[model samples]
Structure formats: C-alpha cells, structure tokens
Target: MSTSLAWESNHGKDPDVLIIGAGISGICTAINLLRHTPIRNFLLLEKGSQIGGTWNDNQYPGCCCDVWSHLYSLSFEPNPSWSREYPGQEEIHAYLKRVCQKWGLYSFIQFNSVVEDARWDGETLKWCSKVRVTGGKSEEFAKEGYVIKSDYLVSAVGQLNMPYYPDIPGLGEFKGTVMHSARWDWSKRIEGLNVGIIGNGATAAQIVPEVAKTAKTLTVFQRTPNWLVPRDDKKISGMRQALYRYLPPIRRRYRASLMDFRESWYDAAVVEDSDLNNTMRDLCAELMTKQLVDKPELVAKLTPNYPPGCKRIIISDDYYPALNRQNVELNTGTIEKTTETGIVVEGKEIKLDVLILATGFKTVQFMYPIKIYGENGRSLEDIWPSGARAYLGITVESLPNFSMLYGPNTNLGHNSIILMIEAQSRYITEMISQVHHARSNGHTLSITPSNCTVETFNEEIQERLQKSTFASDNCNSWYKNEDGVITNNWCGNVIEYQNRVSAINWKEYEITGSCAETLLKKDKSRLGRVVEESNSALIPIAGVVSMAALGVAAYLVRYGPRRIR
Candidate 1:
C-alpha cells in the first residue's frame, strides 16, 4: 500500500519514522530497512538538496576515503570495479547514489526538509516533530509550517558535517580568502596565489599536496606534528575487480583482515608498554625517513612528539612529497594570530592571498547548535551537559524508538565505518520488526536498554580506551575532545562491533507500550548471537580485531595512580 501524506500541517502530522540526515550512514540505514523490514512509510529528512552529505560538503582538492576501497563499502553490495585502492569522494558519492537507486530510496526522501526540534510525547509514546520545509515548494500541511508526528526517529546526521576553525583573532579583517577544508568554495580560485594553511591534520596534509600544485607559495603552519604513514595506494586492476565481483568472499576476507590489523595497531599504540610505544614510534620514524631524503630537520618537523595513536594517524601518498616542493614551506613556528596580510607566526610574517583552515571539526561539541528534545519535556541539549553519550551510539534511555546510526563512542579510528553501519542497520531493522510484531499482537512496545548494561558497556570501553593509543598523553587530536574525553571511536575491532550489534541481548531492554491496541502474537525479543567462536575462520582476522587488552595494560602503567577515564 502506497500512501502520501502532506506535511505535518495537513490534518495530523504523521510518518511511520522520521530519519534525520541523509548522509552515507543515514542512507545506508534507510536502504537496509527497505531490504529487511516491511517499513515503507519512513520519511528521510535531508536538510540539503542532494543525497550525498559529507561528499557534497567536502569538495576539497584531495578528498578521499582513508580506508581501503574494498573494505569501505557495504558487505551485501560489493563494488568490484573500484578504480583505486582508496576511492576518492566522487567515486564514493557515485557508489552511494547507485546504492540508493538500486534500493529505490529517492521517493522516500524529502529534500530541503529540516527537523527543527523533536520531542517525545509520553502520552502517545511517539515523536512530536516540529519540522520546517522550504517555502514555495509544496503546500503540504494545511498552512505549510511543519509540526509532524512519527512512531520512531533515526538520527543519522554524521559528526563531520560541522567544520572547525581556530579562534584566530582578526580573521574577518583579512581581505584575502579564508575557507575551511569542509566548506571549500571552488569559485574563489587559489591559482598562482600564496596560501597559508592552519593545522596539519589529515585534511591539511591531504590539501597541502593538491593546493601546492596550484598555489605560487604554500605555507603549512603546524602546532604539533602527526605520525604520517605511507599509503601504498594503487588503482584496483580489472582482474582484481573481476575476482571480487565473481568471488565476494575474497573481498570480504581481505576487508576483515585489514580492519583486524588496524585494530591490533591501535593496541600497540595505546598499550602501556614503553617497548611497544617505542617500537611504533621507531617504525613511524623509519617510514618518515624513507619518504624524505637529506632533511633530518624536516623529518623532525613532521615526526610527532606524542604517542602514535594520540592524534589520528596520518596516511598519505603525497603529503611528505608535497612539502619538498620548491614553493611549499613547512613552518614549525607558532602562529600568534591572523593579520590582514597573513598569519604572523613567531617573528616571521608570511603574506598570503588565501588562508585555508584545514583544522578538522567541532567534534567535542556533539549535536550542538541544533536543538533536540527528548522524553518528559527534557531537551537533548540539557541532557548532555558534559558531552554526548548514547547507549551503543544509538538510543538514549528516555528517548524510545529514537535511534542514532553513527552515534557517540561508536566511531572507529582504525577501520571502515561501513561495517559498523551495516551492523547498526541489522540491529535497528530487528527492533522495527519487533514493533510490527507488537502491533500485530496487542501491546505497545518501546525498546529500552538496561541501564546496568549500558553503563557497564561504556565503563568497559572507557577503561579499555584509557590504556589504548587513543588516550595516551600524546598530541591532542580530533580523536580527543576539549575535556580530553574520547567521545568518538570504538576501541574494539570492526569484527567485535559486528558481533555486538548482530548479537541482540533482548534481556537488556525493557519493551513497554503498544503501537496499536489489537490482538496479535506476543512481541518476543529476538535474541541473537555471534555465529563463530572467538577464532572464526570464515573471514580474514586482520579486518576486525580489538586493541582492548593492550590498551588496558598501557593504562595501568601510565595512570595506575588513577582510574581509566
């Protein structure tokens, strides 16, 4: 049955589910829902015109996925014809478009639609959504202003959409161009111009190589150096693509192995063993030396003083090489502030026509600026005074039927987020299915995870992360927030995350309330379990392995004096 309801203003505003953010994770969630459940009435609310969120937002010169191409995609829909080992933004965007088309998610999407605020209605146990759609588009609701309702809410809005800029004084006074990497404006050309880039993170490193090719003189200002690694990138051969296309398990195994290895390195970096840290540091230095010749000073400038995993590990095929370019200057001096002419670093004042702020995102401030209200007249803003915390990066205790796809502490710094996204979809789809089962049987259902379980879950992660490379007293990074709290990233392997999501512990949630008062089968919890033992042999071990144990050991050595964060 196909039914189209006008905007919330029409009669009573209602949708089966309201999905916020039509990004990769969000789109994936929607597509998976179509594949698994009988959910046809969900509204995909995208603030922008197009479907690609981050891909649309980040149009910087050298934009690409950090993870290898084979692993970065969905397990069900493997693309054999990946041009490069690591696909660029355009390819990833096109892949997403194809995925959407294959699953037919376009009709369900509402372009230019924004959710102003969503509140939980306790009486009905539904989301009372206050939304706003662009005017002059379609007169849906009787008047056009949005106030809708939905049985469930899915917050798939990604973390990286918000751009971060250093509080450089006198930034506006600069007559020259200033742009964040995420908000790159192509119309304002940087051709033959002198450009000053602030903060040498992943984006900065990537941008330097691309912009250097164009700019007359490019100066990269560094606060602290990140551990840079060689990305052995290459175009996927036709034969390799054919192999993955015909034999999917090969791709799957390779992806799993890669994820596992990366996760293991996390342990080595974060673990308390000075021996391990030293080994990692030595290995990183060796790689740096291999890239640059006869420039020990340059190597030192690029080498991180902090632990390997403290900040994000820098990976690039061009970052170090770009620095060696004649026009490019890597400045190790401190940037006092911005001047109208250029950035005044220490005593030297380098003039620039364009200033690019490749300084990462406002990750510490989770779900900021945007207003979100949960159950019992409680605002989501008010709930997270310190920082955002979600049960499995999805649900809040009071917020029933509300799910966040790529929520807090669920981020992985090591491997592909695609793996996590798939698992999340599976878990969510099961929950939605249960809701349907509940309606068929006579009971209202709201999936609420046990507080003990949730708290233990976070505590365990916190304990493990404290000892991991991510929490070491290294250079500050986007990985760590303002308060030095690691709010993002799963410290475990992608495989472990898959198991956690796939294995549903129904005993953990309190399912109460009914969608419709009717006679049907009792909505029993569909308990799940990990298919294979700890040492499963179907896939490669490198893809999804945890650094949890090593991280814990490292924490004990460093901060045995105190508790793990």
Candidate 2:
C-alpha cells in the first residue's frame, strides 16, 4: 500500500513519459509502453491508495459490470477463470491488480499523489507537472508539493471519475446518513431502517434489489425511467473454467464470440428507427411485462417514453421483482425539498432513516479542476470552452506532445471500452516513439494535431451523433453536456474506431522542434519499424514472418533498402 520508494528516489529527474491516472487506461498505456515502445522511464500518479479506477471507487451493494466478463478484459492477457458471465467489482479489481503484478507496473506507480496542474514548457519542450502528495502511505511527502517533468504527458484520468450530486434545496439539512453510490460507506447499516434512494439509472437498478432484501421499507425516487433489459447473468461452471484455462484457443474463441455478439448490437444503438432497434425495444418490453405481471401499476410508471437507447439501457433481472415487494415503493414525483428527516416530494415528506444518492458521474467534463496550460501559455480550458475535442480522441490541437485516453467522443454505448482503450494505447505509444527517436538524436520535438484536423474530425462526429439515438431531444443522459452537445460517446462501432486509430497519420499533425526536419524525412521508415516491433508479440511465428515480409515490401515500395535500419 506504500508509494514506490524507487520513484521517490528519482524525483527531480525527468522521465520519458508521465501518466496521470493508474486506472485501466493508465495501466494499459503503461503496459504498452513497456512491451511495445523503448520508453523505459515513465511514471503513473494515482490519487487513490489502490488501482482499479471505477471498480475501486464503487463498492455499493450489487456493484458489477454490465459487459460480459470475457469481452471486458485485456486482449493480450485474457482471463480464462472468470466465475460468472458478468464479473463483480471485486473480481475485476483483482484481475487488474494481478495484471499489474505480472507486468511489474507497481514499481512505476505512485499512490496517494494528486496532480494539481501541468503546463507545457515551450522553451524546454517538456511538460512540467505539479503534484501534491496526499497523506496515506505517501505521508512522508505530504509536507510540501513537488514538480515532476517529462517529455510527454498523458491524461488518463477518465470521464467517469468525478461524482455528480444534484443541487437539491436543503439537501444538507437532513440528519440521517447520506451517501453517494460511488463513495459507499460500508460501516453504515441500512437493515431494519427505512431507506430512500434518489435517481434510477444503472447503479440504482443494481442497488434497489439488494437493499430491498434487508431494508425495513425502501422508497425509490426516480426522475426518468430507463429501458430495462434482462441481464441473464449466470455462474461459470468449474468444468468450463478448467477447459478455458487449459486450452488457450478455446478462451480466445469464447472471447471473440462475445465481442462479435456485442458488436452486432451497434445498429440497435445508433439507428433510431432501424429494425434492430425495434427488436431490442420489444425484448425490453417483454422483460418488464413478465417481471411486473402482478403489479400493473408499477409497470406503467417504469416504462420509458423515450427510445430504447436514448439513455443507457439498464440490464437487470431482479429490479422489477424487487419493486413488486410489499414494503418497496416507487415515487416518480417532483422533489420540492429535503427536510431534517427525509425527502419532500409533491407537497409530501417521506420519512426515512437513510438516504442514498445514486446520481452518476460528471462524464461530460473530461478533465476539470486540473489546470493544464499548453503552448504559448494557452489554457486548455480556454481552448475547449465549448467542449472537449481531440483528433481520434487522443491528441488536442494546442497541446504539444500531450495525449489523452478515454477522452471525449470515445465512450461506447453498446460494446466494451477496453477495446477502444487498447487501440488508443497503441496509437499513443507509436506517437511517443517518434518523440523518443528525436530525443535520441539530441534534438527536442513536440507534436500536436492541426487545428483543421481536429475541427474536421469533430464536425463529422457531431453530425453522425445527430442521427443516433443518444442525441434524441426527448431524453437527457450523461452522454451529453448541458448544451445538448454529444460529448462522451463515439458515433460508430468499435471496429470503426479501432481501424481509424490503428495507424498514426503524420499529415494530420503539426510536428515542430529542432529535429522536425529529420523526423519528417524518416517518417515512413520509423512507422514501418514501429509496426513490426510493436505487434511481434501478439502474432504467431508464421504470422510474424508474413508481416515482416509485408513490411519489407512496403519499405521497398516507399524507400530503398538504404533507409532500412
């Protein structure tokens, strides 16, 4: 649980890269750097005591992933021993920790260190990050703040890190225990107590069933209803686990099948009135009708008026059944205020012993409360006053040698985000390789996407989002900002994103510095080298030989053997 003393010993020296979070995106990026790129000196600054970004934060009752366990893991390090169709929070966290341990990532991570601000030093062509060490296992560095500089800076503090609380009048006056879904308090017991929960999104759907089993009386205050579908979660048998563990091909095939099934639902998510969308809507309706057959009144209140994919579809098998309990009640009224004892809705105050806020994260604000200055002392906030924008959701226009993972317009509505993160990690490592190549020649270098490239990319994204279900006027979800701009989700399927970011387009960027001329001359040769080196581990020997042959052909077509290294 202590911070890495090795990282502390080299505090003043500059690393090759500095990553801001130790979650899935950050850890995946670090692994890619170690395995693919030649950048050895990199640091990961984590605000929490442990890794597993979302999984570590959310510990409420019934917290689990909606995605299948097999499809949700890293492609290179697939786990064949999952206990269920969908893994719970603890299992996912443990998997990440094991992956970190296997890849030796703990030595590069500094826990309990919060990044205050980071500025791109145009003169030095490096990112100077100011970090504050919060007292925990890192208490020795808590007395004062310190600065860490790196040639490249990556912001992996993802979209869903900050919790959002509704501005309800007099919410602080309540004397009972209050808790957000992300920051769960395990010591506070709600058994035999009348508990009330506000908001009815995916987290609330998971929580309602578990709390109803023990609470004296549970009241759910919902603002809007979400499309409810059957999760169909089941336990994985020991025989199946053993088969997957022993035969790697079977595990690979299983994971591929899950990914293909999930990808098939892409049309249902993006096409508002397509046949697939209608079919999914019918399935969700059938699930609600069968689950709430006895309680006809509850079914009417739970039915969503908007389209199925307007908001995130809730997958649950027990939510409706939990609502059918005699002691549970669903309130879809306007919240006027909150009193000392409970919530007041529609001129009536419902007494409660505990209150839970299931309101989700501030996803639209990609990176807030962290001041970031780019070239010529330009603030990132000033550049992105409207909303965050990045070319391929990785590099911004004004930020030089800076990249982001899981940034705007990269979140998925139907498939696993791990796929997107992997694509991004590969793309980023390739870009960093260019900078490292320049540094090895004793010349400073910085790279950023052209303003026109970012603008054109975002224009296409926004236009495509207009045709998707998420941009519907009838629904308000976390996928957008207050201005109704679709800022969080990608407009296409995962394959499209992966292919788009698979290779770096040098023409789209504005590369500068003392080595810009030399780097530009060797772009094709460097690209070929990166492709052959980075993916050698993933392919079989025959595949690698074939790829090497293809790489030589590409090199010969572009430049002669004299340019080969």
Candidate 3:
C-alpha cells in the first residue's frame, strides 16, 4: 500500500495578530515586530504550503536575484554565509525558510490558508477576515473557507502574485508545452528540442541564455527593447565570505551605503543633472549601440527611443551574447498569432516545438478580487479603482489601522527591492507596535493623511514620472497599468523615503477610543498638548468677573454689616 504523506490545514487557529501572505516582506514584518515590542498577538497566514513565497513559486532555470547578496538579507539578521554575490532562487528560498525556522515563525504561520475577504465592524472594532484552506477530500473548493477576527489587518499579498498571459489570438489552441517562467515545468527536459520564448523582459533575458545551451534551436520574441546593464554577477570569494560570517555588521553597513546612493540613480536622469545624467545617458546609448555594433539592424531594433531609467532596467551579462549565438534568433517583429507548429510574425509563420511565455505579472491589480472592507465597510478595490495612493506607501486614507508591506510606487527599478522591503517591513513593524500600544492603552488610532496631502504626493510622483523612462510614450512597459500610469515604481531616492518613514508624529493621526474619548470629553479648549491661544481674552474675562464679584460682595456686606457684629 502507498503511504499518505501530507500536512494538516491551518484554519480556525486564532492568534493575537493575523498576517496575510508569508512572503519575504511578511516574514520580515513579523520578525521586526517580535524583536522590538512585547506585544505578541501575531500569526502569519500563507496561501502556499511552505514559508517561501516567490522563491518557492518561481523555480525557472538559472533564476537568480538581480541584487547583490550582501544587500539582500535583513539588516538585523545578516547572513555571512552566502555562496554567491547574487544568490539563485533556491538559495534565496532556503535562506528565507532558514530564517523562518530560526525565528520559530512557522509556529505562528498557517500554511495553505488563502485569505478571501476582510471586513471591519465599528462596534466590534475588529476586522472579520475570511480564509480558505486548500487540500481535503471531504471539503469542496466552493465551501473550503473560514472566518476570523483581529484588531488590525495588513495586506502583504505582494504585487507579483498573479501571473498574466496576454490574450493572444490562438492561446487556447496551442499544442505545445507553454508555461510562464514563474511556473516553470522542470519535470520534463528542454534539451535537444526547439523552443520559442515570448517577451524579452528580465525573466526572458535570464532564461534565454541558460536554455540556449540545452535547446537545439531557440527563438526570442521581443515586443520592445530594454536598456540593459551588464551584471557583475559572479561567485562570492572566500576572504569576503569570511568577513561577512565573522563580521556581520559589514553587511548592514554596506546595504545602508548602497541605499543612499544607488537608489537615487533616477534623480540624475530626471533632473537633467548634466554632468552625471548626460554621462550615464551617453554611456548607455554607446553600449546599446555597441552591443550589436556590427549588426546595425539588430541594434536599431534593440535600441530604445525613450530616455534611460524610464522603464525597469535589466542587468544581463549574457543576454547580448546569447542573441549572438548560432542556434538563437531574435525576432523583433510582432507575433500576429500562433499556429500548431509555431508562431506567426509579419504574416509569416515561424516553426517551433515549445512555447514559453515570459510575459510578467498583473501587478497593477493590487489585492483585487479579494474583498477587503475597511472602517466604513468600504472595499480597498473601491477605494482605489484607478490605482492605489498612500501617504507613505503604508496607510490609505479610508483604510484605517491597515498598512501595506510594499505599497504603491515603492518598487526600485535600479536597486534591490530587498532594501526597500526591509525598510517597509520595519516601518510596518513600527505601525504594528503602534497598534499594539493602542490596544494596551484602550485607544484606537488611525494615521490618515489629508486627501489634499495624498493628492499632492501623487502629483509629485506623476511629475517625476514624466521624466522617467517608464513614462515614455515610445513603448509599453509592465511598470505601468492599463491606463499607463506608473504606479509601481519609486521615481526618487529610497533613503529619503526611509528617513521620512523612520519618524512617526502622533499629530499625523487621530487617536480615539475609550482613553481618548475620556480625555477629550473633559474640555474642548484644552485639546492641544500646549497652549498657543492669545492670553488677552483670558485676562480680561478674569478681571471683569473679579470686579463684578467684588462690587456685589461690597453691596451685600453694607446691607448685612450689622449681623456678624
């Protein structure tokens, strides 16, 4: 008889605090909260069975993080034991799992529990959350769900959860083994077969070079040319590795240093900082042209007409070389449709055996379809149907006591999101501590920026967007939504954002509850922490009352002066 091996469901287990999605950001958020504050009502809820989120899902060939390994790990919990300068997906996944296990986050984590909806009731002052657990013979897909309540709600369901495939004409009719890089089918081999890859984004750029060696013939369909920077991705050496292991502070110091400078790469491009921006532009243009300098036709096809730093720039050490390979052919033409044998381009059918769609994620759809009702029974999707806008990329105006791990415009096209993730996680941890503090003090606090403030921030983002490579009308990029609004990237320095988020002012929010109401009902005139009103009114009122009382006392004394005597 075959053995039945499986893990049980993580439903109906209530903790002090419930976190949705056990991604890197989620794990980091939990870790930071646990480290700082004494409040411990936290539970990490993951949709998948394991702790590693993206690292677990995207297992494509040669998949690796673009950021330097030294800067990728948490600042507080540094790993001096990285194998490479840039770690692969497996290593990254293993690192996260190890961190999760080390901190005993698994005990708090409920795997395979998918969150469906969250509604807030003012009377209860608790967010009623519904979660569904996958896998059970008795439970049907339609009815496998549960409900829970918590003081605070956070949506860490990252921007890259849902995979998107273009509605190309003959997608359902294709007979080949087609899959996204995020969900790479590795059970079967790719060696000695003709393969055609669609979209030349970061994933395709990485996969093309790796699969080229195995596949007999390879073809890449390029919708638009991306500005490429050669990645200095190589193995981490022994001496440096030893330093990291022996001296952990080295990693944090390095990350902080990089965050200050590299994240502002866009500022130069946008500001027209001539000496710096012009130099970078000229250099990128030169490289773009020189990449296939001899092949002018290919260069022309590959070179972007938009300014540098407009789109999410990719780092490829082998993409240019891969395109020059004998077995590979770069197709710059639009793919009209797909035939059973292959894809058609420019009214001509090109034959291929396998089709791989490296077409990225549906990132613009932030927590859509998942019903999240906030303070006023208002849905998050309804709040930002056009796109999400937040004060500090954490708190939404109407969504009270809720925070986002990596909210709108926080993505770094130049630096590692890990840095941004850590900053965001820490910021959220601080907010969690605030919630914990409020609960302890019998107060419900909400840090809501004015609509004017939110609008002003968005306007600034748009102004910067106009100068970004992402906003170029020359091409379509994933950094934008259907409306072409660049809501997914940071057009400024991350360090500045870090500093702004690091400090929290109580004045920014309206703190109200039993404690607040008790204090507030006492006096309307004494609301502020300090008195700033003019003293002339108070002096005149006291003087006039004193004189009136004196005159009345004198008259009564004269009339009754003989009684006491």
Candidate 4:
C-alpha cells in the first residue's frame, strides 16, 4: 500500500484504494483486494452505520431476496445455515456481517461516511475524494467534510440504495403516516389501519400479502401489472444443510445448477414473446386463476396487458391469494390528488390511515448527488446528460483508474446480481494490480477507455435492447430510461457477462507514462513477464480462466466424464 500523499487537504489516511459505498459490491471488492491482489491499504466508506447495502437498508415487512439463497450469496463464501430457500432481509444482513467478521473486514470500513465529491489529479495521478464524515466527534470536520487521497477509486455504491418518491400532487399535505418501502418505518403501527400501497412492483407484491393480514382495509394502486411466478419457497431441511456443511462440493454443485437454470431464463427476459416467456405467462395465469377463482373482476384488473418479459417478473405464492381477501381491493385508476387524509383516484376518494410507497429507487441516475470529475475537470453528470454509460459497465472513457461495480448495463433480470458483482470485482482487482505494479517501478500509470469503445459498446447494446421485451410499447418498466433506452439492464445472460468482464483488453484503453529503466533495474527480478503481460491484451487471463474452470467443474459434478469402453 502506498502511503505517499502528493497533495494535502485534510490530514487523513492516504490509501492505495478508496472505495465508495460499503454494500455488496464494496465488500466483495474489498475482499478480493485484501485476499487476491497485492493492495493492502484500502478504505470502505459507507453512508449507513453498517455494511450490507440493499440487504441492510431495506427492512420492510416480507422483504427478502427474490433469488434463491444458494446462488445469491458470494461465490467465495458459502453459507450452509440458510433457514429458507429464499432468505429474508434480516437473514441476509446477518450473513453479510458474518462474512465481514470471517474476513476481518471491519477495520477497513468507516460507517456513517458518505462520499461528497471525487476529482482526478493529472499531476499526482491520484484521486482526491471529499467525504462527508458523519458520526464523528468534530463538528467542524463533519460540516466541512474530510479528504482522502488514493491511487484508485472503486464505486461499489449500487443502483437501488437511494429511494425514489413519485411526483404526486399534495403528497406532503397528507396528515397520515407516509413512507417508501425502501425506507420502511418498523415503529409505525399498521394493525387494523386502512393502509394504501402505491405501486405493483416486487416490493408491493411482497408487502400486499404481508400487510393485508392485519390491515383493516388494504388498497393497492396499480399503474402496471407484473408477470408473477410462484416463489415456492420452503425451508432447507436439516439433513440438506448437514450435507452442505460437510460436503462442500455438493453445495457447490447445487449452486452451479441454480446458476445454469437462471442463465437459461435470459432468452425469456430479452427475446420478446419467446417460448420460455409464454410458458412463464401460462404458469402465472394458472396460479392467478387458481388463487382468484370466483372474482373475475379482480382477475381482469390484475392481468397484465403487455408481454411477460416487458417488466420484471414478480415471484410470490401469497401475493395473489392475498388479493382475494374480503378486506383487500386492487385499484387500477390514475391517482388524481392526495387530500389531508387520503388519495383521490378517478374522482373516488379512498380514505386511508397510512400510505406506503412501494415505488423503487432512482436507478437511472447513477452516483447521484456525488460530484465526480474526470481528466480535464469534466463532470460525470455533464458527460451523461441523458443517461449513464460505461465500457463493460466497469470503466468510463475519461475516468482513469476509476472503476464501478454493478454500473450501467450490468444489472441482471434473470439471475443473481451477486454473480455479476463478483465478475466486476475481479476485473477491478486486476486493474488495481496493474496500478500497483507501475507505482512500484517508480512510474505513475493512468488508464481510461477510448471514446470509440464506449460509444460502440453502448450503441450495440442499445440496438439489441430495442428489440427486447424491455422496449415493449404496451408496458412501462423502470429498466428503460425516460428516453426509452434500456440503461438499467444487460442484454446478455450472467455467463455471457462473466465472459465479457473476465479480462480487460489493453488495446481498448489509452495508457500513459513510460516505464523507467533505473526503477526497473531495482525490481528486475520481479519484473519481466508479470509487468509486460499487465499491459497486453491477454493480461490477467488466468483469473478469468479460473472462474470459467469453476463453471466447468460444476458441470462435471453434475455429470462425470465417460470412460473408454
């Protein structure tokens, strides 16, 4: 780790890497850096008091990971004690804490530390980051903010952390308890109260069922209906857990099977009205029909007009059944206004004691409120006026030595995002290794993708997405931006994405600064092939190959190779 600080602002620890957002991406990046790479000194700045990005923040009732527990976890750390097939918010948060403890990552994390700004310095070849220091004793430091210098910046701040409240008339005038599902207030009472939830996405799918059990009257405002599949969640038997704990290979095989199954669903998500999509739609329609047998009106209102893959598919066994309750009602009318006590929809005033905005986050706006400047003092916001784009969803053309995990176009619609995060983290870790190798040889290295590369990549992806289900004219989804461009999701499957991010192409980037002979001679014994390959196209292919090999091994575990007869 380099402790040298070329520029002075606030006297804080100067690390080799300064990671923003201590969520899943941040933690996974840190784990790779500490264990896989040569980099030791790195700081993880989290806005909240704890780690576990999405899992820690979202604590609403019935909140849980839609993806199965076996495959949703980090590849390196497998948990054998998952209580359910799909773990809830609290369980996920606890799993993260245990992983952190196992790796001793607590020392690297700074809680209540929010990033304010980050600017690249061409002179020192370092990133000077200004972070808002909360939970600190010094009021002056907290107000003015503190500074930290680093050779690399990893943005692990994911897309879904920041909650998005809709622009509704008189939303503030409501005298009742109002909150977003992302920012759930557990203390607020909902028992026997008339509760109104505004949204029909995944969160609402979960909350509707859970809240309907106790609410005196439950009304769900539906702007769009989602294709829902049965979760079929069940408890992991003790014997299965024992098998996972004792025979780790069996667990790995199961995880790999889960991954392959998810990857198979990619076509259903991207290819419009494909066979997989039809099958899913039929299955869901059956589930809906079975749950709401007598109420044809409710069925008609709940049925989606668009194709199955037009929006995200919600998974729940209870959401449909909950809608059939006598006390529950589903409204598909436009919300006109909000009064002091309730909301008016289509000239009907529905009185409610509590309003829950299961409306999601500002996903299109990546790295919101945090000002970032690249080479020549160009702002990231200015560069992305319409929407965000990145090369391989990891590197930007102007932001040298800066990488983002789970950035634009990297979000998955069919599989676990944890797999994607691991892939991106490995790529970023390899980049950090190159920077460290250069610095050790008394040379500063800066890297940024070419403009043509980013433009070409984004254009190709956008073209593919235009034909996908996300671009369906009949339905509106958050995956598409206001411009109707699919900026929030990837066009390919998890394996394809994993292969794409497996290795960095040196030709795609413009690398500056020459390697000095004097400094090279001092480190000659450790120099040759490692440093040379770092600047080549096939640089760090071993890491990628290793991941690919794991996939192959998983295949063999399911079916062994045939012997010669």
Residue-level lDDT tens digits of model 2 in 360-393: 9989877776799998989988888898888989
Candidate 4 lDDT, tens digit per residue, 1-565?
1222211223354888989988889999999988877777788888888899988889999999999998879878999889899999999999999999998898788778778889999899999888776775433335556677898999999899889999999999999999899888989999999999999899998899899999999999999888877676789999999999999988887886676556656665567877656655665676677667556678777889887778888878788778888999999999999999999999989999999999999998888878999999999987787799999899987899999998999988788998888888888888888887888778888878889999999999998888888889998787878888788898876666777776566767777756433333332112111111111333134334324533443343233332100
Best by TM-score: 2
Give the lowest summed-lDDT range of ten residues in model 1: 556-565
Clashing pairs in 2: none
Q: Over 4 Å off in model 3, which ranges?
A: 1-13, 136-143, 249-257, 268-275, 288-296, 441-450, 517-565
Name the TM-score of candidate 3.
0.84
What C-alpha RMSD separates each model from the true structure?
Answer: 7.0, 10.7, 19.7, 8.1
lDDT of 1 by residue, 1-565 (tens): 1123454333343677778888887887788678877777777878777888888788899999888887777777778889998899899889988988988888778777776777788777778766566643543432344656777788888778788778887888888999989888989989899998998888887789899998999999988888865566777888888887789778766665655455555444555455555655665676666556545569877877677767777777677777877898889897877788988878677899999998888876665555777667878767666667777777766667777777788887656677777778777777776665665466667776666766777788878888777776755767667787788877676667776775566666666675422222333434353232224652354223333433443343334331111
lDDT of each: 0.72, 0.84, 0.69, 0.80
> In model 4, which regions exceed 4 Å deviation?
1-12, 136-143, 516-565
Worst 10 residues of 3 by lDDT: 524-533
* Model 3 CA RMSD to the hidden true structure, in angstroms: 19.7
Better of 1 and 3 by lDDT: 1
Q: Write the per-residue lDDT of candidate 3 for residues 75-133, one digit (tens) a residue.
A: 66677778987789989888998898898887777677777788877776667777776
Candidate 3 global lDDT:
0.69
Listed in order, each prediction's TM-score against the native is 0.87, 0.91, 0.84, 0.89
